[model samples]
Target chain A: MSIAEKLNTYTTGPDEQGHFGRFGGRFVAETLMPLILEVERAYTDARRDPAFKRELEHYAAHYVGRPSPLYFAERLSEALGGAKVYFKRDELNHTGSHKINNCLGQILLAKRMGKTRIIAETGAGQHGVAVATVCARFDLPCVVYMGETDIERQQPNVFRMRLLGAEVKPVTSGTGTLKDAMNEALRDWVANVEDTFYIIGTVAGPHPYPMMVRDFQSVIGQETRTQMLEAEGRLPDSLVACIGGGSNAMGLFYPFLDEPEVRIVGVEAAGKGVETGEHAASLNGGRPGVLHGNRTYLLQTDDGQIVDAYSISAGLDYPGIGPEHSWLKEAGRVEYVSATDAEALEGFKLCTRTEGIIPALEPAHALAHVAKLAPTLPKDHLLVMNLCGRGDKDVFAVAKRLGADIE
Target chain B: MSDAAVATHLAQTRLEKRFADLKAAGRAGLVTYLTAGDPDAATSLEILQGLPAAGADVIEIGMPFSDPMADGPAIQAASLRALNAGMTLAKTLDLVAAFRQADREAPVVLMGYYNPIYSMGVEAFLARAVEVGVDGLIVVDLPPEEDRELCAPARAAGLHWIRLATPTTDDARLPRVLAEVSGFLYYVSVMGITGTKSATREHVAEAVARLRRHTDTPIAVGFGIKTAEAVREVGAVADAAVVGSALVERVRANLDEAGKARPGLADDVLGFVRELAGGLTA
Candidate 1:
């Protein structure tokens, strides 16, 4: 490769061993290795086939309500009084978030691999709802493992999953959150490896998964790049997105990684605050370690015991981030920051009041960062923030937090 | 059997010697697994010291971590109990060192996830493990694909790199699973976590037979065997019977309401170990 090509980090990555430098690799039990390899092989073949692309495009346009509008947030930019802001508007997607983008792609791969059963782990229930939607479309049996705590808070999505003929199992293990849910899902996959395809709802799992999920979700950036150019005749000066296991953020950041001029910022959820040591900000407070398959930044003890992360946003309430995000954070390709629960609430309210868009609490963290960073930038600076999810599912929790009277 | 090559490289390990002694005695072996500091450190140490006399031909000391993902509820709880009682990787090694001082012949293996050892640095951890009289290492997370990380270095340090081949390990993947594998080949009897489900004798026998085609290392069948009957069933086919969750579950059952070890807990656990060992003799 030429020096210029070598300078571009995007040309190739996460080499055959599934490592993005040292962050991403297939550090799974032997029981799951063969299955993971099968998934990788099927996905590789599907990527090379034209029919797979056609099928995904067909579903994206007609079923998932693709190309979710890139709305120029005039009032939000006015309120910030600095950069011209644009919202990616992924909240308008059929499943009400950016999750379906990858869910749709994986369900198609599962079908190609002759996998008849679908199992997924979900935290905020958006991924569960999306997985259920795809399973319903493809006529496959779906089981979603959700923490009992998440089931209590995300009752509506649980009901939605059941209505779509998917069984929702409550994981009652340690802390009863995303981390526990992932453990339970992995257990199920190992026990039922014959026909089951575990659609890990993030870019965090062992190899092929981080890269495959990133590829599946890259449409977010691909579309954003086209729309930004169509709208402004140039790429946005900066891009921002919230991260849990970092699928949405990876999707938005992948296309721009080679564009040296486009600054990328990832918002991590600082539950109370990073200083308080109660945050879900792995890149901010945690160190590099292995969990849920890949080696990434994790909240762990000196003895390597995983500690539960605290966050008001169940979606971002994870103990670790995606391996690629870990790589990017270390590679200096992405600036990682955090937003407190109180600041996320403020961002939620600002988006609702100013732009008349209610974002899921997960993406509110990104907006919280934007509310801080946008005001400091010059007015001519173009900035894009992924509005990853709709707040319809979060109204009950938000109302309770706001101390509002409910009938 | 496919043990010719691996036996030559790993024959010097304490584990190889223990299995060889068992073979000379014309009996299948009982490999017992106990957490390093379950309930507390005192009773744990006693159980560790008494296992060989109680009929255990090999001992696997679980190095407890925060999340034992590949383990079932029984072993998972065992890990948490050990961690809650202040068990660290260093402390686990200390427990092994203490056990090794008294019993020089019992093969001692340290089993758990990789993060703790990784946190301690692989080279440093490998040196410490060898120094602590650790014979083998069973890291559930490290497959052969990740050999450069720990397997190669550990093997070079004369510590056996024990590999686990599960029901999912097909013929194509078995060779890779056996590569650089020393000590013994642990065949996880079921396709699930430790202690949750048991495989049929037919399944265990068939798996062991298939694995015998790949490597000559002694094959220990684990995952579901609990009682003497289960142990005898496994001993009938495999070279050794590994009972973990059952032993840890016994520890849990003997604990007081406050999760402390009851009086006579060590003797009670040893009695159970003798009962399990009786199956191998039969």
Candidate 2:
């Protein structure tokens, strides 16, 4: 309780109207406003009920594998030869990523709201597979919208979603990427407002979505706090994570926001370079605009038409980041940096060889930053990075990028 | 004015004046919509200049956004065509300015999402919209909860703050949607986006009657209105029938395979608007 009060002073966000310092608000149409409010009310009530808490805890412990380990990367730390590096092993959770942490909470809320259908949008298909898994567990109809471009890149996870009894709809609009898939998902939500619950895959939608998804994912930071104390006998010196709509980063950063001694950094994916104008680093390269039901920094043209974002990792190829991250960036509470695709590839190779852990390309961006920053600090400095996703889903793509044909 | 009429009269803007003129004429008006620079800016301006002569009472020029989530396929493609032809928010305002030069009687509304105006800076855009003689605004994403963002400021700048009341807007939610509209309350006749399935006439009548119980604002029903008979059926219940996708679809149908406007694109679009207006005039 004291920690909550301490953190509240650093993070005063998403007021009742959901404005995170002019970054987030209810920017949806009138048809979805009432239903959005309904979801908010249901979530608020469920948050208060002890039974809801117990059910969520039970599922987190037994189903989704809560309390993912914080392991000291002895070999990687030695290789960097500066800061001691620790990897938060969220990639070990069910479905091979931290996405299930949010999906578990949202699907439970959907069941509580008596919603018969579940719909979601995915970029790398990790969130789609997570949502399909939870819906299948809860015995609900699930539909996932993925862009045609992403479907071609992430075929394995798409097959996983279909195997879990979810309908995967291929979105063929605009650039046919994550933003277009999100637009199509919103269109479906509008048409099916009565019986559907839209489980936004990240911390970026209208009012309650940004706030609710953040709460669901905060377990990562909370567990990290406890484990870091037990392991190092004190809080870490720094935190690093990748940003793709920023669910995992927000999760790992929310609990430690008030710790002024700790430095937090969010890494954005720079496809080629920030100067190339083809990257997905919103805060680095974009101006503030509205899209996907929230006001956030968006990669757009001078006339405010959203441009397609490019990244080697499909998950980080979205044009906008989470609105709360926008607020945090402006507030200067977190340092934002970018890593190019070449750097991420280098980091991926280093981690796989040294630590025997193949990381998802999304978090490879963070590892790239860690590789640079760790060698600059003292050997005793404790730096933590969220290895947010496993690399199995990205293996084929990485092989193709490395000029190897994996049959 | 009676109490209800006085309550609806929030401003002496062009929309209020136009609605009063229509009431004096003893018939509902016809509202037509078009993407501002569809096919090309010159042709779009010509179509805009000819709409009043084609019997359009209220004209809506859609600002083309790269992502039109609330629009159906027809308007979505129309937006793409306009954007591909290099239509911009400034160009859309320019079209309105050019239209106001010839036909100053019909009320003009700029309808779309909020990003373009937000990107332009709210004050600058509002000043330009007023400079171009735009009557009102209908930003679909800016609900009443976000009134402080654009609606209130635009209304104070002399542009009517029109809002939407969807079919899902029950009795509890109607007043919130109604409270922000100083011009006309746009009633989305379906629970979906533009060009999708339409609402039943009985449902719209009941919805309009219920809205009348709440406010005396002029009601304009839109979405899924294709033909003159459908417009006539909707006009029988509401103060005006707003046809958007159908008219835009006509512009699309007249385009060549290379996506350029074939000959007489404006004439084909105006002829459709003229036939749609005949629903009330006949």
Candidate 3:
């Protein structure tokens, strides 16, 4: 069945309490229940009210800069010599990545809900920067939790978040990475559930988060559908994007889940490889376990301890994918695949050389697949990929990996 | 599943209930560990339902704190997830409110560091616990030297203030673990963080027997009680077995794969709990 059909519409049943199939339900504590229901009610009301939609549309277009262009990569396509490639320029969004799209929308919703504080967690600090940017704009007290490890690795974005007036707290527990940051963020939210709004970076969390994030980010797919129709006069043959918590991929894929003609592929980070305990390809290598709120695919040991995950790209280094991705993979509506670090490096260099676009290492994983599949597919076939972020935040890491030293 | 059988099943006020129930049903209660609110309010609820029919029985809902000294990486990750999910000490009570609506039988214990409760003030939290029908609370860092703030109030409220006795606790301190502890004595089998491994009954049996001398409260072992075999071993001595990080780790590991919530998986895990419970009786 299509993704839309699989998702609970909540028209006549379950109220607006948030239900996705039988798996998704609002089993929240009583303190936040009223607030969550309020948010759901507001979202529902806003969704139906034309004025609210128009206001959101206006901000998305003018403030956050929505309708992010879909640029066809002629050079890369020609280099590939077979498949046509198009890049959804989310990398060009306000905060330099697609993370801003969801952040801005959530910040706006926080404002509507009368939330005075904004809490967020970041892996590579992209989401932190995005949340900080919007919270600063909205004048909300923003607190961003980043793993101590990520803060050091992604220093530029960490500084950006602080500069944007968000308090960046470094989490020291666990692997001191995204997962730890997420844990700290949760602790903060629980502590201050009264007036705080949590801006989740990915589509991985529970019910309303995955659904709400997908809705906000779905603008990517919605706009892509319109833009693609205008540009190519038809839908693309295939769509692919990197899946960290899968928000970007879901945003781009939600619009085309019913178009059986348009195949969807969610690429996971293979790290060094799926083996050697160095990968984040949960669907390919992980077992089902509970981590970060939901029971989803995770990289863990036989005893159920969450193993540390590694990837050249910090953004895609999470041990679990979003539960919806799990559901989709099980349903076979979309195919889950992986791209290795070596392949991603090649794709990173290829994008730089062929298209002069220094894509983030996360999307370079998707680019790696393009390099592998383009030559094999028919020349007339088209592939649309979400260029989720720019490479600026990753320059140091990339430089170290590629042995390129700058004077 | 007869009431007679359930009634005939010993009244398990202490840790012994887990084993008693497990033996009666021939299935282990699925134990899921979560922080009160990690990401936000919505996700915490989603996680509660995701288990149960899948395998969980006892849900160890964590109360998020600024300092959780007892937890290791994965559980710390989970605690953060629950905290991020928008959990609070007050919200922890709120979680129990929702929990009571759908599930009344499965014992829900609030586990976390003592800071949040201390911050919340003992009396208010104990009252809230009674109001919310919380079965027990595990304040990991609540040393016996200074637990009157929580223990005294919790007992007055008719709630279980479960205490932990690590391998470090000796014959001198072992009796203290049972003296003040109501609900169940969470015997930390190993000397480490909440998610570490090393479930040896040989070391634990001494502690269990030591506690058995003082109070009749159920002696449930935790910390490293992870595997089914380990559960059986711990159950052989302790009145009830507390398997947390392992069960949570199992739930975490099974996510996203096909047939994760199937009856077979539930049966496999439940059967393991039952076997351990049976071992407790055997």
Model 2 clash pairs are none
Off by over 4 Å in 1: A1-6, B1-11
lDDT of 1 by residue, A1-407 (tens): 43333455763778999988788888888899899899889988999999999999999999989988888999999999999999998999998999999999999999999999999999999999999999999999999999999999988899999999999999887778999999889988889899999998999899899998899889999999999999999999999999989999999999999999999999999999999989899999999898888899999888788989989999999999998898888777789999999999999999999988999999999999999999999998999999999998899989989999673
DockQ, per model, reads 0.77, 0.83, 0.04
Candidate 2 regions with alpha-carbon error over 4 angstroms: A1-8, B1-12
Arranged by lDDT, best first: 2, 1, 3
Candidate scoring better on TM-score of 1 and 3 = 1
Models sorted by DockQ, best on top? 2, 1, 3
Per-residue lDDT over A221-251 for candidate 2, one digit per residue giving the tens place of the 0 to 100 score: 9999999999999999999999979999999
Candidate with the greatest DockQ versus the true structure: 2
TM-score of each: 0.97, 0.97, 0.63
Worst 10 residues of 1 chain B by lDDT: B1-10
| Deviation in Å, model 2, residue A380 alpha carbon | 1.2
lDDT of 3 by residue, A1-407 (tens): 66455554322222233333333344222223334556677767766778767777887888778889999999999999988899999999888899888887788778887889999999988888999998888889999988898888998998898899999998888668888787667656544556888898997664467777888889999889999899989999999999888889989998887787888999999998987778989889986654554446777654344667788999998877776677677667788999999999999999999988999999999999878878888988989999999999998998988788962
